[model samples]
Target: MSELLNTSEVFASDPSGLLRGLHRQPVLAVLRVSERQQAQHQLNLLVEAGLRHVELAVALTPAWVELAIELRQSFPSLRLGAASVRCLKGLAAAQSAGLDYVVSPILEPDLLAKAQQAGITLIPGVYTPSEVARAQALGAPAVKLFPASSLGPSYWNSLAGPLSPLPYCIAAGGLSALDARLWLESGVDAVALGGSLFETSQGPQQPLQLRPGLTALLAWLEQRANGDLLSG
Candidate 1:
């Protein structure tokens, strides 16, 4: 753990390079399924479609952690992480489960410190410049722009300026293909697809598969983003 954290710290101050270097894909999909069967199916679908980066929500239950572990073993090349990590326990669970990183809805100082000490990558959710600054102060490698749909692409575009030493921004929450394209074009390092990708009318409680709509959208967004979405 200490060894991993030591390596993680090297990129703590400049996560943009790390994120871009590690995740060659343009988007990171968020999975919030509750059933193990459904979860595995959805993961397999995404992998088959060429999407590798994913954040499995930890709020579900111990099964979520187990699924993460299982997925990691099955898909060795998958970049798996935990999302909605609100407290120490969630962070600890993610670390124990051996996932790649943790995502929080809000930035917690103690959580950040502990993650740094444990060698886990904590991507805190941030919405404003102040929040972004706060995340940077905590040494976060990346800051997820939560409920990003609420702020719209214009809001994301507005942040491109003034936010010096900008952290790697992840456009998450209610992201559409057009929205994803706009965010990526607006300079966001990466976009996160949540319920919009894997969830269906059955809701999160039921097992779901990757939607054809989302698959098409991802392809379109990847092309539209063009040079904005890096491959190397």
Candidate 2:
């Protein structure tokens, strides 16, 4: 475990080039399925659709770490990570599998310190201004704004100013395509989606697939990316 925390140059300050690099395609996919094969298949689909960043959040199981490694081997350019990482075991799993980073539900000093030591980027979840300040003080390069849809996209706009230069913000949990548009417009650095893509009136918890809204969201994201390039 010491090797995990003591073997990189980006360990000192912040994610050397992690979150800052997501401006090109600002959508992150959070895969929270129970079946391993299903997760692999869904991830393959996301990659085919041009998604490069994803978090494996299926109960913080080491299942994610294993999947992240496999995905990386297949697509070297892909950015794979584990999610819901809230303890030492989770962090160890993240490093054991050599994932690019890990995401947590809340900021924990020890977890952050471990990430900093390992140079494995950690994007801790934040809700209020005080949490944001603490993350910034900890030198977090980015933070995930969890359950952002609960507060609506406007919440970001409300907090963005006072938290000027906020750690690269990612809006996650229950966000739809329109919500993604609004959050991005509100200056959220990125938006993450998971089971929301497959939600239906049915009560079954199905494994992720290229569901209806997903394709549309991908197309829209691609178009926005092109527009960003042209505008730039």
- Candidate with maximal lDDT: 2
Pairing residues by index, what is the TM-score of model 1? 0.81
Give each prediction's root-mean-square deviation over alpha carbons: 5.4, 5.8
TM-score, structure 2 vs. true? 0.82
Lowest summed-lDDT stretch of 10 residues in model 2? 1-10
Q: Relative to the unseen true structure, what is the C-alpha lDDT of residue 14 in candidate 2, on a scale of 0 to 100?
A: 46
Considering summed lDDT, which 10 consecutive residues are worst modelled in model 1?
1-10
Off by over 4 Å in 2: 1-16, 58-64, 199-208
lDDT against true structure, model 1: 0.73
lDDT of 1 by residue, 105-189 (tens): 8878898888878867788899888998888777787788898888876675576567754766787888864456667766677
- TM-scores, all candidates, are 0.81, 0.82
lDDT of 2 by residue, 52-79 (tens): 7877763555665666667667766668
